[model samples]
Target: MAIQSSKTVSACLQWVIIPTGSHICMAEFFKTSVTWVVDFHYEGRPRRWFKAFGPHDDPFQQMTDTLKDLYGDRAKLASVRKATDEEELQYLRGEEPKNSYCPTGR
Candidate 1:
């Protein structure tokens, strides 16, 4: 059931059609979520930000979709992964370097 639901979520993130009878998973069922630090270069300058990945979400694709909008087709992705505890803390404390970082509470 989880696998099927994951497929559904993946399809949804990609805007792909999921055939009938596919299971859908709710975000509540996911107990472990991660805060990703997305670093990239958009239009020749570095852009950094945080994005949360919930249980029903596809992390990489979400970043791709989001960065695409801001960075355009030529955006260069530097890295995308779970944020460290220190990184998260710095962000919460408003100490992160000036960038596109937007603080959304975990």
Candidate 2:
């Protein structure tokens, strides 16, 4: 279930409290699930990462599809491409822009 209006994820964080937490919830917070494009792949198996979400908020069905569709649409893609860095920060709280770039600062 989504936290909805509440910004705090403490309750959800408690779900990971090993006495601690569910394996799935742990996976989501860590961003190590296969759903994250650059996320770690466990052993040789790619996890069904979106399975951590409840059916109601289906991240895969909702966010991923929208992301893919926008990626395929030139107009939509152009709009986001013009976003300023500050605006981009707010836009990607969870949303993915197809040409995601991660700076390594290396």
Candidate 3:
């Protein structure tokens, strides 16, 4: 579930509860599950990464999450697009593309 706030809430107040002053709402955002091929840079070298997202997942948000998990502020996402069937198959089969670099920095 994603927590979103109304316009009435100020930017600084968004992080904390105003008790009786602000109105906050919790909403569920949903998107179709998708397999994405993400192009990014790691250690100044271009690389590729793939992942399947859940129905509620956002691709851009996932990219940020990946950046935090893998590079801790160094990783940068370049491109994101739906994965082709062959690419998805390779990802599922635990195989990496011959022409692209894919490494788990962790």
Candidate 4:
């Protein structure tokens, strides 16, 4: 038989959350069998990076927990919301859209 090297398998989710009145927080969630990695961005730049080694089976839960621990009362968890299509486009373009939620910033 031929020898083969094992490759790591992972899943990723990209989303933006607006926690109550706070500025938009962009997040990317990456999950593998042994760990979870999250990257957070603000105004198209890296803000925070987090990684957790897991015995836990749920990646979503890990993401939620990480967010909760990072931004507490200043951000309301129940108000966490997804990014709009325009917001995603703006982020990818590294510039603010014409009708952006926060109109002042570029």
Model 2: pairs clashing at backbone N, Cα or C within 3 Å: 16-20, 17-20, 18-21
Better model by lDDT: candidate 2 vs candidate 4: 4
TM-score of 1: 0.56
lDDT for 49 (candidate 3): 70
Q: Which has the higher lDDT value, candidate number 1 or candidate number 4?
A: 1
- For candidate 2, write residues 9-96 as lDDT tens digits: 5665544222334766776664642222221122332221112333235443444455456444321211111334554454345443
lDDT of 2 at 67: 43
For each candidate, the alpha-carbon lDDT, in order, equals 0.68, 0.35, 0.68, 0.40
Q: Any residue pairs clashing in model 3, and if so which?
A: none
Q: Which stretches of candidate 1 lie over 4 Å from their true place?
A: 1-32, 100-106
As a whole number from 0 to 100, the lDDT of residue 67 in candidate 3 is 85
List TM-scores for all candidates, in order. Answer: 0.56, 0.19, 0.54, 0.27
C-alpha positional error of residue 71 in candidate 1 after TM-score superposition, expressed in Å: 3.7
Model 4: lowest-lDDT 10 consecutive positions:
21-30
lDDT per residue as tens, model 4, 69-96? 8665333223222345665455546564
lDDT of 1 by residue, 1-106 (tens): 2222344455447444454433333344334667779887776777777766786677778788877886578787788888999987887687767744434321
lDDT of 3 by residue, 29-106 (tens): 213457888888777777777776766667878787878797986788888888999988887787756434424422
- Candidate with the larger lDDT of 3 and 4: 3
Clashes of each: 0, 3, 0, 0
Cα lDDT, model 1, residue 15? 47
